[model samples]
Target: MQAEIGTPEAVGLSSERLERIVPWMRGYVEAGKLPGLSVTVARRGQVVFSRSAGLRDLARGLPMDDDTIVRIYSMTKPLTSVAILMLYEEGRFQLDDPITRFLPEFRNMRVLVGGSRAKPETVPAERDITFRDLLTHTSGLTYGFMDATLVDRMYREEGVDFQTAETSLADVVAKAAGLPLLAQPGAEWNYSIATDVLGHLVAVISGQPFDAFLRERIIRPLGMVDTDFHVPPEKIARFASNYALGEGGRLTLIDDAREGRYAKPRSVPSGGGGLVSTASDYARFCRFMLGGGALDGVRLLGRKTVALMTANHLRGDLADMGQPRFSESSYSGIGFGLGVSVMLDPAKAQILGTPGEVAWGGAASTAFWIDPAEDLFVILLTQLMPSSTWPIRRELRVLTYAALIE
Candidate 1:
């Protein structure tokens, strides 16, 4: 599919800047690398640059429209964390509350011991899993995809479904409960199914299904019309196909569309990885977070709560927090906040930005960062994998930051 080159005036973008970024984006498409891409940058609550490039569907040769929806994998975590924090603001619960306060199954959990393949030794949990641990990923939950250890292998063997699978959130939690934790709760950082478990807790605490609570609290108030776990019939065609690098440098389409399983009201709305959203819709969320728990008089969280959520809550060696597969990537040594990654040291993070810049991405290569110090929020969307490997993000950050030079 050919690229849609909107003039600077047509899209309210700076022509020179758009022209500059377009080549890098198009180069990948022209090189048979990426299939579809869309990026939007906002400054002080107004979109200064919004551009859609490449084909949304390579088979049909559909151009990526501005409104095309992309699957946002882990990016859902921040929003889910916010919803959880909103409950915190309502005096519904405390961050330090043991998760057992809501879910009893986790009350007396045990940690894995001996060898990776060995059965977990029954050591009494030193402490109960707290809501904060869930938020920061300090809770010893494991994502089946990121590792290949015994427990991780077991997670996959049992089909620990993330975004693409048909499993419900309750199914995920029940499976997680049976698995041995990699470490004691709050003892070390290991990114796991902790957020998905938090989703179930959200359901248990709010007395409403996770999806309903999120809609009633965050999505509705923020005007995120196109953000949800499933897409309706009308929006399905515009949904971009998931793409990945294939043999011999070819781009192959992988179908990730939601089946009927996700279409109906789901019992498990994954607080961790169950959201599909557009660049614009997600921008509203990023904007609200950048605006300090409020947007246009619609405040979803208290200013103090938003501040706490973004603050670095990790202690001890930051490396103990979670073992990211991409440890060498810029996010290494970074701290996890309630639902997002907190940049403790720009030098340590190796990203060209200020400290305290909170960020997260989805499995489908969707990413966004809220730089409160710079008053900047940058969101990039694409249906692919290994989001950090791309130069688009780093270059975009540099370009965006360079433009703000005083």
Candidate 2:
């Protein structure tokens, strides 16, 4: 394996941590586990290790560069969550306010118990799905395809179209209103398009398009040049090709022919899964949050708001749906905070990390975690699907934690 630090991007990181991360990156690529990756590590607002490895596109033999843009799917959620908090900090709305206050269709939402018809089982929600619930995933929203409950199946049959390339967020939410909710408001922890709902709310409250609001408030201020819901035609060559395993164990390039805002600008801005960002740019964002919401004099939120976003909001019995099988080497019983995953029980988590570490990932093999206790954040970005089931993410986290001298 080969390793080298290009140059010191900044200071304040232990040389030991930089030395440790280099080999893990080399080993991961040498083993042909990841096609290409961009890794960035930071401590107290300074970058320690920033490097790129492997080929961005295996077919065309495109070498991975520092400027490779990647799809950060659900990682966009934290940004959306921060946008919501910004509005909260502005006193636009309270966390406990019913979603119907902005989106009237959400008022008389019902839960689906049995069949095609809205069954005999029905009850008024004890409380409205709050802004806090949107952050915590306790709002009882289902992703439609992940869980195999009756409602999930119905979601697949009816809701899949709205998530497709042509459908807009408004179309998706309107369809969602027609379907029965998985549970009462703020009841169980179900991962769904709640952030998309927040995107709509951002439109309502800010009097601007969701994407426009994000661009004005967050993206432009942070100088995130390449971060956006769509990749412009001029920048298409910079976008990495997403890949997945196919029959006979051959690595195949996944089809990305789906349309709308991802490849080209569209009016429907998705807060849930619509963002393309580069490593350095996203690192700036993480640094802002890790530094308690202010970066380079641009404060998107207050320090206390940053704390509130990362706090453990899961009540007694209602937490994550179940412990997801991250990989053979790791098990996570983590719960959702506002927009990130909070490591609830380190002992039960069976991974290498401190408790209170806030983390989440994108669908395209990109993941990151910020450990406030250690004042450290690590980001790994790649363009591959089905990334959660792989062991590399856990191993990377384990090695990162092991490198800490303190």
Candidate 3:
């Protein structure tokens, strides 16, 4: 079903104030800080504000539109997490179940104790890596690009990067399994390829290819027709060019829309950071989550399951884990849920957001947040790489909440 488009006033927001987002966003484009951006806000299951600015392709002068598809990167985690919970609801596996139950490669996993990149001292893991550890990123895995530790360097040397198109997901997980973990299981939260491991488990449990299971069970059910691991031939023109700030602060083309890696099928469907989607398509997904895991008549998860997924699963302050220096958001007053971040205290976060808000973002400055308190959801899509390069997410949060006059 199509979302009912309504005036901002109908959803308890100031229409005049909502228009301010356009100029605010256009300023980033004008300053060459971003190539293009598209934003959508929905309240009470109705779209209140939608806008786009600048160009999707700088060279071709292609304008960004409502339907422009852009890489979502790490935002893919939430969807993969939901897929795992879906199988959990089907009695496939318990949240605390050892992952080695299915993948024996993970059995007797070891943790890095001390050593150089060439040779590392290791000790046996305190316990087996569990499904909860994977969902909350406490499984001790670490991404290579985000850190400079010996384990991270090991990840780099092993070709553990998610952007690769050559290796399969199974192979990637197998390689990671052979490496010593960055920490003991459930000891700390470290952003890693745990979601890709979950993706492999999804394939194993569902008896379907990872991409096929996502398309069949999640993407199609919620009517996210344009979301996929790759853009089809017909939709290539609508795919946006990815950009990164280069030397001297000029926009550099990182990924071309017409002939990029995503233009063709990829061998490894990166559940950690490899999905492309549009503003509308993702809004529908947010609406599904906001609707308690159902959209229209399709129900992907139970209401209780949705509640559990969004709740904070952390035992102590996220800061206790020695939060990664390169992380985009502050760890104080924030906790990891199944796949998203749960706001334990908006004031501590220094952001204008509600407590219990579930949110996540991608590497390309794309972000989304679901506020059950206000019955609201917002999606921001863009093509700028390294989302940490700017404070757009925080600015957008303030911009969105300030417009809620009601």
Candidate 4:
């Protein structure tokens, strides 16, 4: 909300062309593709456009508003990634340093070579899982929900979950450490729970609780007041309900704002996918990143660190990295950076974008992208789960980019 609003024409964008977004968004809501949604765009550090549509709570007849607080889910990964990098700037640890240097539990971790969920084979990891591997998602770790590999099933059986709040982050990460990895560390790029481990690292290295470190070092400093691990009682009214796509393309309420876990305090704040934020709050985040790690005269990271974080760090695109069968991103033309996905070849990715732009989305179809090259960024917030259920992000890129006139 602190962002100064500007006319699209003032920022080298065509207002008339931007209108193309209105009906496109309304059609999604009218067609029941989303419960509700919010979209915000900025060029050169000024808000050029923002819009919201549909219902935040269908049964309550509540409409989605500009201030609706929604679950950002995996979008939390980038914040966690930044948290650890702050420590990296402090010389707390080197990127290549073994994570076992802090959490000894990961020592002698094994990689799943051959197996069934009931009976498995594993080998000692060739090298220790490094901080770099964690940042780039080259870590051998896997998410239980992947359900594609034996190691993923192991995560389920062993209870290595970040989604549920009953288990603390310490407990869940410890569970992951004991389980077999899906690949050798740094050998493959699989979207995994590495950022959750990075959050724990931030705590251990800074001698502060993970959430506290983020709140003090990142959230508060960035002026993102509404961004937090849980929605407070006073803010619950503004929280948007979360929905899952059902059997017949119908929307089903999965979590209600009044009594959902987000409504109260929880033990494990999933650094991977637990934050609740509003359009304005997250726009500040995107602005901070687009501003090269600082905003409102507060610098959280140096210019070089931001550059390193946004640059592609993979051997090739995710396709070359043998990504697991389940990522919302296309395997080609996109590469993993420290915390976000970097555009490698837009032509190959077949999406409308400039190379080197960075982006990531949540499980709820919430997504954001920062184009350093263009000095522009866009954010979409909605309450539809299993983000893959729709192709909203791709279409938004074309609509947003087509409006650019300079």
| Model 3: residues with Cα > 4 Å off, grouped in runs | none
lDDT of predicted model 4: 0.89
Model 1 whole-model lDDT (C-alpha atoms): 0.73
Clashes of each: 9, 0, 0, 1
lDDT of 3 by residue, 105-156 (tens): 9999899989777678999998999999999999999888876688888889
lDDT measured at residue 327 in model 3 versus the true structure, 0 to 100: 50
RMSD per model, one decimal: 4.2, 4.1, 1.0, 1.0
lDDT for 26 in candidate 3 is 97
> Which residue pairs show collisions in model 3?
none
List model 4 lDDT by residue over 1-406, tens digit each. Answer: 3788999999899999988988999999999999888899999878988998899998888889989899999899999999999999989999999999999999999898896766888889999999999999889988889888888788888888887848678888998998988899999988889989998888888999899999999999998889999999898888888898788989998999887889887798788888999889888888888878888899999989999999999888899987556675788999988999999999999988999999999999999998989989999999888899889999999999999999
lDDT for position 147 in model 2: 49
Who is ahead in lDDT, 1 or 3? 3
TM-score of each: 0.90, 0.89, 0.98, 0.98
User: What C-alpha lDDT do the candidate models reach, one value each?
Assistant: 0.73, 0.73, 0.90, 0.89
Output the lDDT of residue 269, model 4.
78
